[model samples]
Target: MPGRTRPIDKLAAAAAKCTKEGSVYGKCIMADYNNVHKDKCITEFLKLKECYLTAYKKR
Candidate 1:
């Protein structure tokens, strides 16, 4: 799986990192499918979203 990748991989990897490093934003992103943490981490999520969008556009 060295070169393997997927759309959700970024988010999933951040979520895993959150588990180890205790990132509330990561937890919010990982579990807030319902937007419960929207107000709390909107800026962080937007940054992550921008990264995801940039990567998506490359492929």
Candidate 2:
């Protein structure tokens, strides 16, 4: 369950399973809300994608 788990699944389950796992899960509540589309992750990812698109357009 430690390092043996798949990285893809581990990342998806990170925010989803925090509550069932421990109290530190509470910390992610606001962060998770602030990032609604697909968690803080997808929001940040979209921002990066936008930047990449803009740069690519210049070239």
Candidate 3:
């Protein structure tokens, strides 16, 4: 199982969203989306502090 490759199907499902230009899995470019994502994609991107909920009465 060492040095194995990942299946493409698993990547497709794991992707949060894709470029709607019929290029769902088109280009694999390096991007500096750290800032752009949090600002432009605010509605979807979750803030770091917002993810912690230890004191909310555990289920």
Encode model 3's per-residue lDDT on 1-53: one tens digit a residue.
56764555434433423223213212211144343432453332323212222
Model 2 residue 33 lDDT score: 67
- Candidates sorted by TM-score, best first: 1, 2, 3
Worst 10 residues of 3 by lDDT: 21-30
Expressed as tens digits, the lDDT of each residue in 1-59 for candidate 2 is 66586755544454343333333333444455655554445444454445544544443
Q: All candidates' lDDT scores? A: 0.58, 0.47, 0.31
Model 1, 11-42: lDDT tens per residue? 56544443333454577667756656336777
> Residue 4's C-alpha lDDT in candidate 2?
85
Candidate 1 residues lying further than 4 Å off, grouped into runs, are 1-24, 27-37
Deviating ranges (above 4 Å) for candidate 3? 1-3, 7-9, 16-38, 47-59
**Given candidate 2, what's the lDDT at residue 45?**
49
TM-score of each model, paired residue for residue: 0.41, 0.33, 0.20
C-alpha RMSD by candidate, in order = 6.9, 12.4, 11.2
Candidate 1 matches the true fold with a TM-score of 0.41
